[model samples]
Target: MCRLLVMFVMFLIPAWALGAPIEIAGRATVVDGDTLAVNQKRVRLWGIDAPESAQQCADPHGKPWPCGRRAANALDAWLQGRTVRCVQRDVDRYGRSVAECLVQGDSVNAWMVRSGWAVAYREYATAYVGAEQLARTGKRNLWQGAFQMPADYRRAQRAMQGEDTRAARVPPPGCRIKGNISSAGARIFHLPGQRDYEQTRIQLHNGERWFCSAEEATAAGWRAAKR
Candidate 1:
C-alpha cells in the first residue's frame, strides 16, 4: 500500500517539476536588460549578463553615463509588446529560471549580447561568444563606452555594502521608504509595515536610498516589493 501511494504522488507531479525541460510562452514584462517576467515567473536570460539598474559607465571622453538603466530601457523598447517564449536550461540560486528566450523567433539572449547591452556570461555558456565579438567590433551601445563587466560591478557593490545588513541608520522624518538592493541586483523599495520592510537595510553608499513616496521610488528606478 505504501508503494502504491508513492507511485500515485509521483504520477501527480508535473514533468517540469520532476526536472524535465520547461518552456514558458506569454507576453513578458521586462525586469531589466537581461531579466523578464513571463506569467509572473522571473526568467534570467541564459548566457548573458546586463548591468545593474543603478550602475554607471564611462563614455569615450570619460563622463559617467547611466548605462544600466539605458540597457533596460533599450531592451524594453526592443520587445515592443511582443510575446516572449523562454525555454528553461537551468535554475539559478534565486529560483529564477535561467532560459534561452525568443521574441518574434529571434534569440533574445543573442540580441542582448550582440547589441552590446549585455556581455556573454561565459562562466555558464559560450554560445553567445560570437555575438559578443560582433558587438565589440561594431562598437554597439555599451561597446561605445568603457564599462565594467556586469558581474564585476555586482561583486564590487557587494564588497562595499559589507556583511552587516542591520538597519542602524534611521530614516528622515516623513521619509521612511526603504530602498534595498536584492542579492539578484534588483532595486526594490519597501513601504512601512510591508513585508520585509522591517528587515530591509539601506546601504546609502551602495546606491540604496530613502524615498518619500512610492512615486519617488519608481521615478528613481526602484520597483516596489511584491510582498
Candidate 2:
C-alpha cells in the first residue's frame, strides 16, 4: 500500500507541473486598456480592460476627458523600467497572448481592477470577479463617475469603424465621438472653421462625421494629434 501511494503521488506532481512557468523580460509599450507590447509581442493582460485613449467617461467633476490615459500612466509607472514576469494562459482573437503579469511580485492585472483603472473582463475568466466588484463599490479610478461598460465601449468602437452592421445602421448624431480613420476610397467632410481641427484629424478619419462645433467635437471625444 505504501509503494502504491508513492507512485500515485509522483504522477500527480507531474500533472500539476504540466504547464511550467515561463519568464519573459521586456520593456512595456501600452496599447490600450488591456494590451501591451513586450519585445514586439502583443500581450493582453488577463481579467481587465482599461479604457482606450479615445474612450471618454466623466470624471468626479462630471466633466469628460480621455480617461484611458490615467490607466496607461499607472501601468507605465508600475512597470516602466522594470522587467515583468508573464504567466501565459491563452491567445486572444487579436492574436495577443493573454496572461497575468507580475511586477515586483504584484499582479498587474489585479492591480488595475482593484484601483478602478479597468473593469474585470469576466467573459474570458472569472478569476478576479471579487476584485472587480470591490473596485466598483469603492468607486475608484475610472469608477468615480458615470462610465460605460468596457464591453460596450469596445462595441461602440467597432460600430464607429463600420465593423458592426447594427451599429453602422444607426447614425451617431449627438453621441460623443471617439477615434476615426481615413484612407483611400473614403471621403470625410468637416467644416473648415471647426476649433477641434486637430482633434477632428485624429477622431474623424476619412469617412465619419461630427455634427457639432470643434469645441463640441473636442468635448465629444476627439483628441489633439500627438506631435
Candidate 3:
C-alpha cells in the first residue's frame, strides 16, 4: 500500500504541476522576427527571427516589402484571429516571457522553422540544428536566397549599436589584434606578415586572439589586403 501510494503521488505530482492550461486571449502584435506582444505583454517566441519592417531587401520584382511583410504575414496567418496556447518558460533578459506557443495543435517554433521563416538557434547545435540545417539546405522560405544567417544578422545589428567594436574597427595591416576563444582556454592574436600566421599564432597564443576565419573577419568588414 505504501509503494502504491508513492507511485500515485509521483503520477499526480506532474499533473498538478502542469495544472489547468491557462488560456490567454489577446491580439498578437508582431514586435520583431521572434517577438510578439499580446495585449501589451511582450512574449519572445522560443526560436525565430523574422525580418524587420524597416529592413530593405529587394524582392523578385526588385521591389521592397517582401521580406518583412512576409514574416509579419506568416505570423498573422498562424495566430491572427485565433486563440493560442502559451507554455510559459523563464522570462528572458528583455523581461518578456520566453514560451513555446501552440496554434491549432502545432508547435509555433517548429512551424516557423518548417516554413523557412525562422531558424532553430542552437548555440550548442542540439536536435533543433537538424531542422535548421534541413530548412537551410532545402532553401525553404528565407533560405531560398542569399539571406544572412540569423547569428550574422544579429551581429550586424549589434555592430550598428557599436557593440561589436572589434568588427567595427578596421585592424591595421601587419598589426596584431586580440580575439576571444571558442572554448575559453586561451585568447588568440592575429599577427600580420607570416606564411602560417593564423595557425602558428593560434597555437602559441592559445588564450589571447582567436584565429579569425576569413569569413568571420570579412563579415566583420576587416580586409586582409596587403599594404
> Largest TM-score belongs to which candidate?
1
What is the lDDT for 165 in model 2? 45
Q: How many clashes in each structure?
A: 0, 4, 11
Cα-lDDT of candidate 3: 0.60
Candidate 2 residue-wise lDDT, 1-84, digit = tens:
999998888777853266765555577777776787888888899877788877788978899967777778777776766877
Arranged by TM-score, best first: 1, 2, 3
Off by over 4 Å in 2: 1-22, 163-227
Candidate 3 regions with alpha-carbon error over 4 angstroms: 1-27, 56-66, 124-127, 163-227
- Candidate 3: tens digits of C-alpha lDDT, residues 182-217: 364433334455444444423222323333464565
Angstrom error at residue 192, model 1: 28
Report the error of model 2 at residue 157, Å: 2.4
Q: How far off is residue 174 in model 1, in Å?
A: 32
**Cα lDDT computed for each candidate against the true fold:** 0.91, 0.71, 0.60
Query: Which one wins by TM-score: 2 or 3?
Result: 2
